[model samples]
Target: MAVVGSGVAGLVTALDLLDRRPELTVALIDKGVSGESGSTPLAQGGLAAAVGPDDSPAMHAADTARAGDGHTDPRAVAVMAAETPARVADLRRRGAVFDTQDDGSLALAREGGQQVGRSVRAADATGAEMFRALRDAAIEKARNGSLVRLQGMVVDLPLATTPEQPVIGAWLLCDEIAGGMATPSQDAGLVLLRAQAVMLATGGCGGLYAGTTNRDEATGDALALAGRAGAALQDLEFVQFHPTGLKSADGRFQRFLLTEALRGAGAHLLDADGNRFMLDRHPDAELAPRHVVAKAILDQPGGAWLDARMIPDHQLAEEFPTVLTGARTFGFDLATEPVPVEPCEHYMIGGVATDLHGRTSVPGLYAAGEAASSGVHGANRMAGNSLAQSCVFAHRAALDMAARLDGAHADTDPEPPTFGRDTPVTADGSERTDLRTAMSAGGGAIRDADGLQKLGQVIDDLRAAAYRAWGGPKPPMVRDALEVDSMLVSARAIVDSALHRTESRGAHFRTDYPDHDPVWAGRRQRVQLTG
Candidate 1:
């Protein structure tokens, strides 16, 4: 069995599988230096749970449902919220750490869309603490031979090429850039991996946008691979835009996201004229739901700014050392300066449609975390809920996969398939840059039919170029070609999903159709790539 990605979802799922079924063989594949490049470690807010005395799973579910704008799956939200405490406990047992108050109790903080303080954090680096725990465990297991960690990119989903088909494994691009042993010349080749079951926890496609908090490698490889393999995607239009991404005056720090936790701790949003504007827009002001804050910021002529001076200098330095250091490195002091801020594409609320257990439309295939649309996030994810959902769903998926393995016949292991050669397609680096620009302009925070149509044309042209390269006589640069291919596939999906939903809801705001259509109320949009 193999799991693609090494983020919180992939690591937890892989570890769970190995722990439960010791005899099972598992291969873990990651595109970047495992555990360092994904969105998990970049997360600053803590995980949300109902462990506080004033909080309950029901309250958490209500907050999630409210933020989701009626599109979140009730059952899925209930499951995730209920499992939060247990999942946090599980991580604690596995060496994860969280911030504590002076009384020795777990410290809780609040973010947008929450009624009370229910987020357990590690000062401000909660994601990093949790990821460290999981990564350390996986590393230990890998050393013991219970797991095989492969540093490479999965270029394609080899099996499940058609609807309802079973997935066996993936085609991987092995190269030094991806941490594999293969050199960067024509000698670099493709490796076909065949496993009994394959799971994609490959995060989201935030990198498709020109400005995103997501890592550069988060190019939506899993979504595109699933689309090519005939898997269904849901709610692709609902892309979450975080309200505060740091932009320096000199442009040295362009895409660093000033964590939302700062606002939760009382930081304010200031306009170009140095006026606190959010107070007039929403009652919660800086604590409004992310979509609301992002839209408000985008509406400003000079773009919105952040006044971190609202938080004390000592608090800024101790609580958010990473953010403070980044600001200082760029000559901006978080405790005094009015840092320029803008919304950046942050998370994807939609992905390969899957059940709560992570089973997709195809058999022998599963997805979790941002890669899978489990409907816990619905249209817009509440802050801090992402890590919670990833951990809980990853646990469920692992158990389901293990159960499947136990029920399989004694000859469950299939004969290894022959390695297949890949026809490399040449891709221009400039074209990749163009694709990001097009996606940001069309499918970003604000959209309309005209821009979306233009974006569609761009994707069509790019797809044609990729196909031409795929069929050409020369051996193509497979990795570059695949990245573009995946971006094109993902871009088209977002556009199509946006076009299909004629109403504005949550993160998806249509300029032409500004009002939420009653027709779309309580309904979720879905799309599949067919060509």
Candidate 2:
């Protein structure tokens, strides 16, 4: 078994599999250092679970459905909401530390679109704390030799010739293994690890946008690889725009995310004129669904500001030490002044289409986390549900894989795909910058026919240029080139999906067709690659 990401989803799957079958051999592959890849550690918000006295799975499901704007699959959302408490408990038992109340019960926080406090957190750095726990557990497993950690960049998955043919393995590029170069000359160093089952836990495609909260590694590699392997992707246009991202004094870290917990704790959103504006936008005010709030912020003439002056000073220090430190370092006090903010590409609501068990259209291939669209989020994601969805579905995938691999019932081992000394795409940093700019300008918080068409043309042009470079006499595989290729591929999918869906819903708001169409409510837009 091979897990392609080292985030919460991938690690949870690997660890759960090892726990179930200690003798099983699992290869944990990551694009970065094993425990430090993807957007997991950068998560400022917490995970949602219906463990509060006033909360229930039914209530959570309703909230999830409302947030998704009627496109959410009831079954998938039910599974996540129902299993959340158990999953949180499992994490707690495995050394995850959740913030506790005075009585030591799990302290919960609220966020946009939630009716109650269901977010279990460890200060404002919930993802960091959760990753620390999971990472420590993985380190233990590695020490015991049940798990092997491989650090490398995955360029492609080895798909079979037939449409339904199972994937046998993947192509991995490691600096040490590739003799310090990813070119075809170092093909000997490019190792192919065969496995019975492969899981894609790679995170979202936020890197496609110029303004994003995703880490650089989140270039939609897994989504692009799956698409190239002939998999169906759903709802690519439904990119979730977070309502509040911190504005950096210096241009360097301007994309840093300001967690929604501040708003959940009664913070107000103010426009540049020092006016409380969200009150007029939605009845829920600061707690309106993410898409609504994001649009309001984007509508601001100068910029949006988060006013947390109403939140008590003691609570700010105790409940959000990380956010406080970050704000103070940037010369803003959360307890005193208003922090500047903007809308950022936060999560992609669509991804590799999969069932609840993580099985994709292609056999022997599975997906989970942000990489897989299990239909739990539908058109829009409820706040704090991303981490929960990742954990629940990843656990389900691991269990399913473990059961199938236990007997000879698994598909027979197929021969790995043969590779030629392939020419890799060439690097041009400007191409990536241009792609991001176009994606943000045209396909961002709002989209229409003309803008989406223009973005699609840009993607086509950039893709053509990349392939031309690749066709040049023996180009070696460069990381930057591959990243741009993946970004372009992912961006195309988003543009195509946005173009197909003419009506506005969830995060996919179109100014030209702003009204949500009842006809398209139940129907999901899917995209696929065909020869």
Candidate 3:
């Protein structure tokens, strides 16, 4: 079995699968060191579970559906909400440590779009703590030879010629990226390997936007790879712009996240005039759903501010030490004044379509985490569900895949055709910046037919440039070029999906049609590549 990513989703899937069937062999592939890749380690918000005394899975499901603005799939949301507690407990048993109350009860925090304080935390760096636990377990497995960790970037998945388009394995490029530059060493080349099952747990496409809160590695590689392999994608347009991203001077095009737990702790969102603007925008004020708060922030004339000075100094230091450090890094003191913040692309709500068991349309090509859309978060995601969804769905996917692989299916599956690394492209590499700039300008925060159409034109132009570059010669398989190629596919899909739906819903807001349409309430848009 091959797990092509090492984030929380991939980690949980690999570990859980290994535990379920200890005789099975697994290979974990990633360009970054295991456990540190993707958005998981960078996540600050805690996981949401129904473990609180008064909370239950039914209540969690209701909140999840409400936050999605009536677009979430009931079955999928129920599964996620129900399984979250078990996953959190599993993490804790595996060594994850969370903050506890004075009596040693689990300390829970309230976040946006929740009726109760059900979010579990590790001092606002929850994901890091979870990853630390999982990472340590994974290292032990590797040392004991139960798992193989391969350092390589997966560039493509080998798909069969049949109409069903089953994937056999993955194609990897041995490359390196450092300080915004990609260079090939002597060993840098391509390799094709077969696997019983291929899991795409790669994170979201936030890197497609210019001013995103995601790191540079989130280039939508897995999303594009799955599509080209004939897997269907859903809801690519519903990119969640987090309501509060710390303003940065680093200018790396990536913004650090200011955890929503701040607002949950009574922080305020003030406009440039030093007025609490969110009160007029949503009934919940600063605690409104992410899309609501984000849209309201964009409406501010001079921009938005996160006023956390009202939070006690001790609380700021103890409960949100990450935010405290982030604020000071940008020369702002959360205990003294309001800090500048903006809405930036945070999460990809939709991804490669998956069933409740995490199977994509293409057989043997399963997906989970930010890379897969299990329909749990239909149009919008609830706060704190990202990590929960990742852990829950990945576990389900691994269990199902493990059972199938244990049967004769792994050997009886039709073989895919011989494949190689995708033909590379050559250019000065301005296409990447151009694509992100256009995506952020036309696809960020707000949308309409006109802006989406213009963005489509830009994607088309870049596609032409890449096609022309591919025709001329086989260029080096540089990481930047590969990422840009993937970005083009994901960006075009986003524009197409954004244009297909005419009405506003959750994170996808159209200026021309500012209200939700009853007709398209649960109608999910899907796309796949065809020859």
Candidate 4:
């Protein structure tokens, strides 16, 4: 078995697989250092689950369904809510300590869209702490037996000899950065691995948008790779824009995400006149659903301001030390001033369509976490639900895979493909910068038909240009091929899906169709590449 990506979902999946089936052989691959690929490491708002007597799984599921705008699958939501408690307990057993109240019960806080206090956090650095815990557990398991960790970029999924045959494994292009070339000096550029099953936990497609809280490596490579290999994608148009992303005066540096937990802890959203604007937006005001808050910010005159002054100074330093410290790094004191904010691409509500057990349309392939649209989040994802979803689905996928391990056969390993190694394979800084700039300009928030159409054309042109300059049977072409292919696929998917919706719903707001159409209510737009 092979698992791509090394984030919380991937790591948890591997750990669960090992725990369930100790004799199974698993190889975990990551492009970067294990645990740094997905937004899991940067998650600030904790996991959302019914951890207190005051909160119930029904209420949690209702909020999830409501936020998803009636499109959430009830079964998937039930599975997530029902299994979340055990998942949390498992994390605790593995040394993940959650913040607790004086009475010894878990400390629960509220975030946007939650009707009850259900978010379980570990200080302000929830993602970092969770990553450390999971990473350590995976490493310990590997040391004991059976798991292998590989650091390299996956170029493509190698299919069986026949068309639409089950994916056997991946073709990896291991480029040598120091000498700016491929290995073996002349040929043998691609390395092949055979696996009985493949799991893609490759995070979200947030990088397709201009302003996003996603990591730089989030280029939608996994989604594109899967799509090219015939995976069905759903709800691609339902991209969630977080309202409180830290924005500079010039609107640059939009990656910083201010967690909604701050508001749950009594912070406020103020405008330029130092007046609370959410009061006029929704009854819940500062704690309204994320889509409502984000739309409110978009409607506000000059974006919004996150006011951290409502909380006490010492308490602020204690609960959200990471956020406080990060604020200081940007020359601001959170306890005194309001942070300038705007909505950026925060999460992709849609991804590779999968069942409750993380099984995709194709056999022997599974996906979990942000990479898979498991029908838990629907149209708009709740603030703390992502982490819980990752853990729950990872466990499910692992269990499902373990059930099939006895009969699973060794994949027929095919001979490696050849490529020219004489060409340079160094990371092109200029190309990377260009890709980022283009995505930001054409695909940023507030996109229209014209902008998307033009963006698609430009991306196609860029892909063609890259191929012309570097494509010729060389290993260096692998990065160019992967990056361009992923970008084009993502752009096209978003644009096509956005065009089909034709109505303003959830995170998708079209100025042309300013109001939600009753006819489109209860419907999800699915996208697939036509032959």
Candidate models: Cα lDDT each: 0.82, 0.84, 0.84, 0.78
**Which pairs clash inside model 4?**
none
Tens digits of lDDT, candidate 3, 395-500: 9998998788852323333343233235554557688888989999998889989999999999999878776776632223667767777888889888999999
Candidate 4 or 2, higher TM-score: 2
lDDT of 2 by residue, 88-170 (tens): 98899889998998998889999888999989999898888889898888888877777877777777777556657777677
True-structure lDDT of candidate 1: 0.82
Candidate 4 residues lying further than 4 Å off, grouped into runs, are: 162-164, 175-189, 407-411, 415-435, 472-481
Off by over 4 Å in 2: 160-164, 177-188, 248-253, 407-426, 472-475
Worst 10 residues of 4 by lDDT: 179-188
Q: Model 2 compared with the native: what TM-score? A: 0.93
The predicted structure with the larger lDDT, 1 or 3, is 3
lDDT of candidate model 3 versus the reference: 0.84
Local accuracy of candidate 4 as per-residue lDDT tens digits, 73-113 = 89999999889999999998888888999999998888899
The count of residue-pair clashes in candidate 2 stands at 0
How does residue 525 of candidate 3 score in lDDT? 92
Instruction: Give lDDT: candidate 4, residue 286.
Output: 86
